[model samples]
Target: PFRSTSLPSSILRSVQLCIQLVSILIFVRVLRSKSMEEYSYTMEMHQSQISDRSMRFVGRLVQRRTMRWETIRRWFPSMVE
Candidate 1:
């Protein structure tokens, strides 16, 4: 009884952690490959373009309504902050 319950919970926690790590790595790669620096006085518009492109690429498989920000918030603590 207890064994079954605890095992699944522990496994789920590990899986979630792995996914979060992969997401972070992918995020960094996308930023670096695009050579995106902090938006400057004249590059403010570019920031939004970059953000939109990143979001589309990373979140393509994830359904907006199903796995919304709230759901990922649980796995990625930094995202909440």
Candidate 2:
């Protein structure tokens, strides 16, 4: 009768430990995945901002080129005609 009672207590302790370990592992995995998602989102935002700036720079260059050509045409209309 004494051995049977002690055996159940030991088994219960081991079961509790196992449950604690499993819950910890699950929590760590969730945190890792959330960090990865945030990292990817930040990277995407940075890339889009870089692309937008480059596009604006290109637009400015094109406008400058067109304005120079127009000035040349105005200064020497006979040459273009």
Candidate 3:
């Protein structure tokens, strides 16, 4: 009778340990996935910002070129005509 009770108690303790280990693993996995998602989001934001700045820069460059052409036309109307 003593051995039978002791056997059941030992088995219960092992089962408890397995549950604890599984819980810990799941927690770690969740944390890692959250961090990865955050990292990807930040990267996307940075890329969008960079692209926006480049587009603005190109627009300004085109405006400058158009202004230069207008100035040339004003200076030498006969050449254009």
Candidate 4:
């Protein structure tokens, strides 16, 4: 008779464990989505940096193309600024 009463309590404990596992799965999914958003934001930052780096390269190329200059801004970029 006591065993029959304990059986229901064990079933209740198992149900609680299943609920905890489901909650953990939900938490993991939310974390994955948040990480994906951060990854995309970093990608956009990299794209902007590429444009900025290209602009600096363009200026250096123009200096090299035009050999006629008072100062050697080609060698010393600080002088160009």
Best by TM-score: 1
Which pairs of residues have clashing backbones in candidate 3? none
Full candidate order by TM-score, most accurate first: 1, 3, 2, 4
lDDT of each: 0.49, 0.56, 0.56, 0.53
**Predictions: Cα RMSD each:** 16.5, 24.8, 24.7, 21.2
Pairs in steric clash, model 1: none
Q: How much is the lDDT of residue 7 in candidate 1?
A: 72
How many Å off is the CA of 5 in candidate 1? 8.5
TM-scores of the models, in the order given: 0.35, 0.34, 0.34, 0.33
Model 2 stretches astray by more than 4 angstroms: 1-7, 35-81
lDDT of 4 by residue, 1-81 (tens): 446565787798998899878756654654465333333333343444556776555445544545544345557666554
Residue pairs with backbone overlap in model 2: none
Q: Counting only residues 3 or more apart in sequence or on different chains, how many pairs clash (N, Cα, C under 3 Å) in candidate 2?
A: 0
Model 3, 4-79: lDDT tens per residue?
Answer: 5557777989988998787567546644653333333333433445567765564455445666656766897676
**Model 3, 3: alpha-carbon shift in Å?**
17
Which 10-residue window in model 2 sums to the lowest lDDT? 34-43
So what's the TM-score on candidate 3?
0.34
